[model samples]
Target: MTTDPREAGPRPPFPGEQQQERPGLTSKMTPAPDHGETSYVGKGLLTDRVALITGGDSGIGRAVSIAYAREGADVAISYLDAEQSDAEETARWVEQAGRRALLLPGDLRDEDHCRALVARTVAELGRIDILVNNAAAQTINDGLDDVTAHDLEGAFRANVFAMYYLAQAAVPHMRPGSAIVNSTSQQAKVADSTMLIYAATKGAIASLTIGLSNLLAPKGIRVNCVAPGPIWTPIQPIAKTPEQIEQLGADTPLGRAGQPAELAPAYVLLASREGSYMSGALVPVTGGTPMY
Candidate 1:
């Protein structure tokens, strides 16, 4: 039977579920996310390139990794050790696409590990032509009073600090045509009250992308960011209460949550030669929500 691609639509009401940990696994998500496994067609846009992506085990990161491999780039995916199974699954897809897939499992919060990850990717893959700093951490708090110092620090460490660490390590190996894509969020501009810390880190990432673009442009490197709107990923069930999950993405102008597959094209565009002139640009895939 032929499958209909358009049949995958906005998620139905989730029955209030939560993962026991942060950055939930893709294997456990209900009606598993679409990472363009059977869809994305490649025309060798990234032929002979090497890419290193953090948080590549699932969600948007996984989607981008798959797309990159299909586009002819060897991909090195880094993810938390707990998500090893998911990361391996992503590597399988890359291998299926006739590209090399390297799995680097570690915590990005550690500066040394971040540096090691870049070094290891270069050692294994030869050189870094693309870097996607897509890993992030988020937790919902009732209010500012409920926010703790640990929560604030953890968010920044995972979302912002890791980006800085990876970029610093990767830049030396990145040639003039190399690209760095950071994953910002719609919250970077909209600012959700319960997720203040997470939103703040994303705001910082947006600024970092612009600033890095200016700093790296002289060396022929491009830095840009993607500010995703409400996309259905494992982060939601873990970050939101069950009731919140049911209403997830309802407030968007499109009246639905986006799929992970929907975000890969933007990353692909930014990493491809087509986007050679695009730097310091913030591409929003927020289902019609204006970033301004």
Candidate 2:
């Protein structure tokens, strides 16, 4: 497995330590994830296609957004209002690839806003060819007792519910051969006690990807998911302790956390014509987590 020197070593606090909200920024990360290195060249795989990615402001979402743009797809990134700067930065990079980027900022928790997200993307880009359900929320807790109704609902809304809402809105507009990619987590399979609620939501997302794939197959729209293991993203600081963040993905077989750029290629494959036969599948970019 090829590894980058920048992502190798004792992890530092994600760049700017501004503890503002659930989803944070790549620009603010201590070591900014490589959105696209010069080695990643455009191949026009998704030429003339349009893509809408939730949480595209940072982390895996940003990586996927940049990859799609480089692959010849116009990109639209949906993020929270607080992440405007990060979202715009992603847009600039997407545009740098000679593709148009629509910056759609709003709360995915709102059903109406979720619908509007797809509408705006389609309106701006002409049509929606790819929909990436990647936005998610999580918080560490002691155990089941620590998991409250609000906490579960918030995680579900951000992680699973909005995925459903966004897919429902985008599917009709998607023509034959369109693709939808959801982001599940390794925790969904080997969940720790501290992340029970968050894991449950991701588990649902894995199932959702399967069911949606079957439902949309007749329409020629493929649906799949990328189950990431411990990745070094802003979510670590917001959801886990500083000490926990320090150890990030050390327990994995890779003995280190994954960078967002590493996972983006999986998304690119699923979103492009290359994955036309792939549907109802979960591709584990989990550092050898052994999903089976």
Candidate 3:
């Protein structure tokens, strides 16, 4: 039960984390990132509730799906149509834990699709007690000249617009005590030049989280965010170069990339009754990097 923190998860120098697409798959990576398949014991903290998780096909979404299921919440996972294989695998894990898993695939950039994601979850899963806005888009740039209008627009649509659309659609269906957990990033505060679009959108998400928390407080809905440092997710492979991927998370004081498994508990806590008094709180699981 006691493992060295420095050696908790896989370090950098990972081979072939890159994929030829925007949203990468989990199966392609060489030392597949752990999603707590054999780990993550639950305590029935979310018995009979339903959760809708964006980007639940892989990475942190997959991990959160597993944790939510094990904790007794039926989960509806959303992802791109291209990620059907990964979605099915994630659904299997949720079902293995004796909870229902709904696979909804579409583009989050569309407002109607974002609304549909909420409607489908409420209609199929009975109700949406939790909404996890975990899906986002990121791309690297050498300089301002390299940042294209299309990429910038797409990033804002997926990362920022989608959150607003989903929240608007989900709020009416949710009852008191429901929770919404958004996944922002450490890049929001620390600022990465190469990730201009990503950092900007993430910063918007952080601000939105605070405003949404207050907006929903009267209804007893909690809104919070998790700002993760460099993690060993498919996003790394797709967005960074081999050199950057190799040294990923090494700069963290912990000396390694955080695993998908490591981020799930925070989501669970935010959605559970234990976090009843917590709202608008941004919890940073950044290895040892300072978020504030």
Candidate 4:
């Protein structure tokens, strides 16, 4: 999705672009991320499919849940205990779309929790046609010496490793035509000074997406990813300071941050039959950021 500079409204100044902080939560963002409630008009691309989305409680995940439901799919949302009210709110939105919503809460850092997340979704929804590995964590540090081993492991477990754990459990229940959409980041390609660890995890996610697409090709399961630039979401508030938050995504050619709603369409397109012929691809929704 592209944001025009003339339409960017007022943007506040922030710190150096190279800094990284925390993975902000949705509740405290300056202007909360749009969950795509009003604009999306579903075309039944995912009719009768069951979608399991990790971190579906907010941000892009919540937007995708609503979009999928509007397309005639039942949804099962998995979230960490960090946010309960948001999860309930997201479920309500899904239900409002006339689709069943199941809430599964747990820590994805644990392999068992990851496995159970998919198992429960299948037990409740019968079969899983869409699995979104969107849950992740990141703690900003100065540089390599500042990154603790624990921090590295934590980021990996939540960002990239959990995808493997959850996919291993969910793939068995998936048949032909199922899709897996992993959330990568612009940092995967454009590295920042403080976000080295976080960027590394996202880079790993990109690699995993390509590898999984090949591994599951024979089984008719498609794997693709959306590498989003800065979209206004909770993760920003938690990860970056208020000043940094104010300037989010301004460095891009568009000179403004993106909204979660703007990024939702990419996930919808990838998960739905509209993108059936596409696989092993990375779709950049980074507001005119150069990727080559």
The per-model lDDT (C-alpha) reads 0.90, 0.83, 0.93, 0.84
Q: How many clashes does the backbone of model 3 have?
A: 0
**Number of the top lDDT candidate:** 3
Residue 154 Cα positional deviation in candidate 1, in Å, after optimal superposition: 1.3
Error of 4 at 67 (Å): 0.9
**TM-score versus the correct structure, for each prediction:** 0.96, 0.93, 0.98, 0.93
User: lDDT of candidate 4 vs native?
Assistant: 0.84
List, residue by residue over 146-174, the lDDT tens digit for candidate 4: 98889889899999889999889989999
Report how far off residue 289 is in candidate 4 (Å): 0.7
Clashes of 2: 3
In the range 81-164, model 3's lDDT, one tens digit per residue, is 989999999999999999999999999999999999999998888899999999999968998999889999999999999999
- Model 2 misplacement above 4 A: 1-21, 37-39
Candidate with better lDDT, 1 vs 2: 1
lDDT of 1 at 59: 94
Q: List runs of model 4 lying over 4 Å from the truth.
A: 1-25
lDDT computed for candidate 1: 0.90
Cα RMSDs, all models? 2.1, 2.5, 1.0, 3.0
Clashing pairs in 2: 14-30, 15-29, 15-30
Candidate 2 vs candidate 3: which has greater lDDT? Answer: 3
Which parts of model 1 have CA positions greater than 4 angstroms off?
A: 1-8, 18-20
